[model samples]
Target: METEQLYREHRSMLIGLAYRMLGSAADAEDIVQDTFIAFAQVSEENVRSAKSYLCKMVANRCIDKLRGSASKRETYIGPWLPEPVITDDGGSLEGDPLSRYVHKESLSTAYLLLLQQLTWTERAVFLLREVLDFEYDEIAEVVGKSSVNCRQIFRRAKRGIGEAPLATPSLQGKTMELVQRFAEAMQSGSVPKLLEVLAADAVMRNDGGGKILAATKPILGADRIIRFFMGIQAKSEGAYSFAFTEVNGLSGIVTLKNGRPHGVMSFEVRDDQIVNLFYVVNPEKLTLLQADRIRPIA
Candidate 1:
């Protein structure tokens, strides 16, 4: 009963933490499940502060997983983006109250990529202290570091990340308006219209994980990106349809080819311009999109 209650309360939070650490929702889910199973083994009377204990277990497990998978990610083909967690996909997550507890902004693909820059321990300390609101002492326990060392690690991580990925709530409306305009421009087949919302130095990255077709490198600059999109449109016209959905808690577009997952596009808006675009078409990463029943815009 205690383990079940703990699972009900902490499963979502643990998954969120693990996802941010590993950048794979599927792996995060697996880690959370494994953690709960381990939790069930320990006597309840021996556990102090169940939340802290579970978080520590999950965090350590994530650190180990990241270390073990470091070479795989380093050797990953093409541009690598986090596996997106879709919220508006008419899936269980859309109505799962547990999901509401996860911090949406921190889950953004951009943010998760920034986290990839940090070392595994640094990521753990920074996330525990900054994102999860764990105290220095608590973070220290989780990472097996002294509180002073944890603080130092966090400071280094802060410097590494530099700035937060998600825009402020005030800019959110503007971001959405720009995304709507972007979709309209794509549908209208107008390069000039697409250029209007894109920054001069806009970048689009496509991740295929070597399992599907994608750009081997980032498409740089607004003009180049627009040209690339136009080229794709000309070649695949009517073969793909796009639907607006929330990807990693930000306005994003999901492309469908014949009602199957083609790609998932997430954006980063700064100063009301689309500055960074991430297109994840890797068949492995599109599993969630495949499961969701999305109504494409005609």
Candidate 2:
């Protein structure tokens, strides 16, 4: 098959892999495009399996990018969060079942944060084996490690992430109901209502990237978080509007101001309570949402 054909067939999958590995859709697309360019230069006869070959190329590029960005993140402003990517049916990956599963599990903000705790090689190995379902030997070939070593690396990555599996799928209706109620409570500045939905030890982390006003550190505990939201409501009474939407495969909200994109928030629910909230308000990170004119609350 021609290189272009190979690219067309595997582009979404490659982008998904890179995005999960690097947690930046923009950087992931660049890496995938570069990989295809490099693939075009290689002799077709030299390739054994096009999918495997392309996967290896994208994996290596992502690892390199991650290694280079480590220092930058150290110096980054505020609480750094993964760049949000729209995972709605037509947004990021293709609509196939496996692709949907991968997007829902691996591309989530929570999982991506856990991935950051892994070393570059361990991240690559873990994703290749667990997320992509590559055989051990295939992973060994892609990451340039022996099969035994790859297993070890995978194990270490799991341990690094506390061996916690991806969150089980939640009831969509219930999750959306919770999100809507939470948004209403915040808008109304109802502390009791907010506390009713939030986990006792709930945590809120905002990523402003120093471009806007945001907490320099995570806001912990439900009471503290409720107070923080109340303060925000007091200061910006009519400045922002929110719409319910699905982000990273879970119910979420998008904040807007005067009809322009402001921020996106994704939540983690456990036992019907909001355990974690990720607010990505950095202007640079909302570019894609603005470009798409994300649906507003009706």
Candidate 3:
């Protein structure tokens, strides 16, 4: 196989893998570009398997980036999440090189954040094994661990799965539908109906970056969630207003007050209802809210 052809074929998958690990699109591109540069420097005769070498290169680069990002993450000043991508197709990214990975619920922002709970190694292991269906042996080789180690790592991650409920129905269709309903209800001020959609186990995670007003801990249960919303609504008398937008593919509602966005909210759905709610009340996270909206606020 020609070197150019091999690189071309696996480029997107490598990048996608990197993005999922590091949670940054820009950083993912840099890592892939670096992978090719490193590959070019190595002699062909010295490289036995081109695909294996390239995949390893990207994975290592991502692991390094994840370490640095995780260390400095708290200083990021708000709810730090993956960059949102819009997708048209409904399948894994392995099919066509031209297909873009959508940030929608199936690959939604909430899911990406959930990926953060696992250790860097755990995240890589899960993405390769569960999402891409890579064999344990292959993942072990890439991650530089034994196949047994890889399986154990994945087992640890799988055990902690569903620790947080973000997207609904665990199905793409149901998630989108529930989010749309929540947005409309928020727009119309239908408090009672909105409460109906929230699950009894519903919990709200707010990231205020310690710079804005927010719950420092996760707020659990439906009744508490209802009170939280009511408190915010009571204060929105010309000082603030809410707008719905798509953030990282999940339905998100952004809060704007006196012409500036103060916070942004995104959800995780389970069993066709809102089981988890995340609000990024920190101003820093809402920097792109205006741009994320379907249309500019009037």
Candidate 4:
């Protein structure tokens, strides 16, 4: 297949992989684009299993990105968070594994922040093994480590993120109804009502990626979480705005200030209550949420 044709076929899935691995849609697009450019430069014959080759290409690029250290993050503006992406297509979560798994994976904004607590290697290993369900050997190859090494990384990564507490297998129909209710409460300025929709031990985590003023640690429990949310609203002085967005195939909150979006918040739901709240305020990752790409996809 022509490179462009192959690219179109796998672009969405490739972006999905990079987004999960890097936690930024923009970054994923950049990484995938770079991979394709490199592939185009090669003079290879018709390749069997184009999808696998494409995956390998994207994986290698992600690894390269992990290796090259970037400059220091800026002085934070406020609570740094991960960039958010649209994962859901306004459809029921009853399709492909990747599309249906964010809620169950507990990959809401909060979980992504917990991810920040880990080193890049740790994060990569955990994403591949736990989130993507890659075999130890496959993850080992992707991460350029021995299977045993990948296993150890997964164990530590799990411990670091063990605070994700919630039970699932609930219908998306039911969970989405509750998400809508929670968004309504926030919009209507019903702090108490909003708190009522949260889990008893609900946790809030914002990832500004050290470039913005964000909670340095996870804010736990209903009371603390409520106080934090209320405090933010008070500081905004009613200028803050929000919307319910479809992110990563899960329903999430997109928060803005002065009509410009600053963060994307998503949920971890159990039964009918939101168990964890995730907010991504990190500008670097926020590129994933952009409505326009610098260069439109081919």
Candidate number of the best TM-score: 1
Question: In what order do the candidates fall by lDDT, top score first?
Answer: 1, 2, 3, 4
In model 1, which runs have C-alpha deviations exceeding 4 angstroms?
A: 89-101, 104-106, 290-295
My TM-score estimates for the predictions, one after another, are 0.92, 0.90, 0.72, 0.70
On residues 1-298, what C-alpha lDDT tens digit does candidate 1 reach at each position? 4888888777877887898888888888889999999988988787767888898999889988987988998898999999876755455555353245345453567788899989888888888887788999888877778999988999999999997756445555676688889988898888888989999999999999999867889999999998887787677746767787767777788877776668888888888799999999898877655445455677
- Whole-model Cα lDDT per candidate? 0.80, 0.79, 0.69, 0.67
List the candidate 4 regions with Cα displacement exceeding 4 Å.
Answer: 45-48, 69-81, 88-171, 288-298
Q: How far is 82's C-alpha from truth in model 3 (Å)?
A: 4.6
**Model 3: CA > 4 A from native:** 1-8, 74-99, 102-105, 162-170, 208-214, 223-264, 281-298
Q: By summed lDDT, which 10 consecutive residues of candidate 3 come out lowest?
A: 96-105
lDDT of 2: 0.79
In model 2, the worst 10-residue window by lDDT is 92-101
**216 in model 4: Cα distance from truth in Å?**
2.7
The predicted structure with the larger lDDT, 1 or 3, is 1
Q: What 10-residue stretch in candidate 1 is worst by lDDT?
A: 97-106
User: How many collisions per candidate?
Assistant: 0, 0, 6, 20
TM-score of 4: 0.70
Q: How many clashes (backbone atoms < 3 Å, residues ≥3 apart in a chain or on different chains) does model 1 have?
A: 0
Over the full model, what C-alpha lDDT does candidate 4 score relative to the true structure?
0.67
Indicate the worst ten consecutive residues by lDDT in candidate 4. 289-298
User: Model 2: residues >4 Å from true position, as ranges?
Assistant: 90-106, 163-167, 171-174, 290-293
